[model samples]
Target: MNRFDAIIIGAGPAGLTTALVLAQAGKEVVVLERGEYPGSKNMFGGVLYSKGLHELIPHFWDKAPVERPVARWVISALDKEASFSLDYKNARYTEAPYNAFTVLRSKFDSWYARQAEAAGATLLTETIVEDFIYDQQRVVGVKTGREDGELYADVVVAADGVNSLAARKGVIKKDLSPDDVSLGVKEILAMPAESINRAFSLTGNEGAAYTFVGAATQGIPGGGFIYTNKDKLSIGIVVKLSSLSKTGRRPEDLLEDFKQHPMIWPLIKEGEIREYLAHLIPEGGQTSSKSLYKGGLLATGDAGGFTLSTGFRVEGANLAIMSGMAAAETIKRSSRSRDFSEKGLSIYPDLLRQYGVLADMEKFRHAPNFLKNPRLYQSYPELVCQISNALFSVEPGPKKGIGEMVKEARKGKQLSRFEIIKDIYAGWRGLA
Candidate 1:
């Protein structure tokens, strides 16, 4: 029976961060990863925000396997043949303390786990945590698949991603609902750095992140994204699982359609597919599981439902890091009193709030439901493209004003003034 001060399940960002913090504080910690290596099963849409990660590893970009600093952000609305985009680029974003950087999880997570290992945290790869070892009503440790593999810990941190086995074992959180999750399918397209820079108008290590709605997903209640890496492009489509099922549309097919789009094809033309990955993303927002801790156990990251999606951006890694820090702090506080019970670990939520994990989730609590409105994904994007086409076309004898173009765009679209106003109000309340 091996024993430690704390045991963290999964070797992803959250679990590794927890291990790193605990190990740095001179506390005995072990991280169990079920994959062949730390990041063998992990995948994410490229961008990793700097603030939360910096708190864990100061100036991490100096040595971390970061692809590029994202200098341009584009949100494009695509109709069948037309597109309208809001593009913003800032030179400062390419400098130190960058806003965010494109990263490949397989490379980044392995590096992060090494940081924890360097800090003296034991990492056990290809180790599956089958179930929680319980002491009556409280969790005491985890039971692995190995012979005599019941490892004990004062506290167990479940960072096992969205489909957390520990969380599902009737303790930390409930099973995720299909309606609350999205299926994200991505591909890494290998290309020359020069080709990437030329295509995206980037310089040096500067990159671009583009998000598309409307025809990108074929009006599915979701969107598509592309992130520029050093010499590869990460492209994918994330669609609500429930909506996808209703349409009987395969995510792979949707991704292929996105790549074939006239607007997207040119950028990724001649690129070779390097890798394909898929994962489930939580979009439950405010309605997501809030129960982060229980007796002798604490859940962090996707296991705790800490991901945030607010239409404009989807954040997970940073929130995962923040939640991991909060979990480590809670365990440290509990150690003072030697109380790992639910009440002792009650401070986890407050710590999460202080870290802005809960605060941001709360701020956009209405966003999930707000985003579910079909009009935003389908009607609104088409309307924007139509309006753009009307404004840009020069062959017309009589040019229409912006207001007239908008009216004309809505005329055959079945959208009424009242419905548009209602959507505007909903957007303000849900996302603002």
Candidate 2:
């Protein structure tokens, strides 16, 4: 049984960042990934915030496998035949330390793992950690699936993705209900870079991130996303597991429908699907985040439910990197004091709070609940689209006033003013 100072499970951003930090600090760190290689099984709708990564590797865009800087963000409300969009563009985001970048996880995670290796971290692929090795009450290491696969370590960092078995090994409460989890299905559609730039009205390395609500998911409590990735487009739909079950529609079917939407078809009309991938996302905010550290074990990234899925954007990659670094910093401090106990690792969560991760989670804790309202995803979009159509339609009749148009739009709609007011108040309070 080989031993190390730290054993990190999973080689995604969280685990690799932790390994990179700890190894760079001169500590013996080993990262075990169940995939054939890092990011082999990982998938995301693309987009990696640069703040955390910039802190890890300054000027990361110069070295990272970034596809494009996201300078345009579009949020769309889709109806059956019409869609309304809010577009925001900032030229400043095209410069250094940009807001975020589109990335392919398979390529990006591999690059990130290499960075960890260059920092002296050991990476073991095709190694599935079966369970944890416990010295009475404290975790000492992990037992892999390999023959005689017990590898000891002073501390265990569980960076396993959502539905992490590492976090379930008595380190923290792992009761993740279907309501707290989201199933994301995505496709990489191959398209020429110039065609994509022309399609999105973008120039150079600028990319567009479009998020869709309402008809995208057929009123399911979820949304669709599109990110430009150089020669391809990362498009996907994320739906709440519980709500999806009630829809009686497959996620793939929803994705196909979303692609056929008028707003979506024009963007990827002739593109060929290069890859289809599905993954689970932790949608639970602070309410679902249990203890982050216990005994000699610590949980980071999605494993600890350190993800936030606001309607406008789903943010977890940056938090994962931050949590991983926080865990590494805590381990470094603990090593200096020769303490590897739960109390010693308690500083990890504090560091998360200090880095604005936990604070963001707490602040957005109401987002998931706020998003549960069906009207926001269904009737509301249709209403807004109909209103826009009514206001803009150049018919052969006298134009109606704004109030008359609104009243006409509400004629057949079942929604009442009281319901709208109540929902508005609730949404405001929930998001406030």
RMSD of each: 1.2, 1.5
Report the C-alpha displacement of residue 135, candidate 1, in angstroms: 0.8
Instruction: Estimate TM-scores for all models.
Output: 0.98, 0.97
Question: Over the stretch 252-313, how does candidate 1's per-residue lDDT look in tens digits?
Answer: 99999999999999999968999999999977776333477889999998888888887777
Per residue, candidate 2 scores C-alpha lDDT tens digits across 226-249 of 999899999999998999998799
Clashing pairs in 1: none
Alpha carbon lDDT at 427, candidate 2: 81
Best-fitting candidate, scored by TM-score: 1
Q: Cα deviation of 26 in candidate 2 (Å)?
A: 0.8
Q: Candidate 1, which segments miss by more than 4 Å at Cα?
A: 287-290
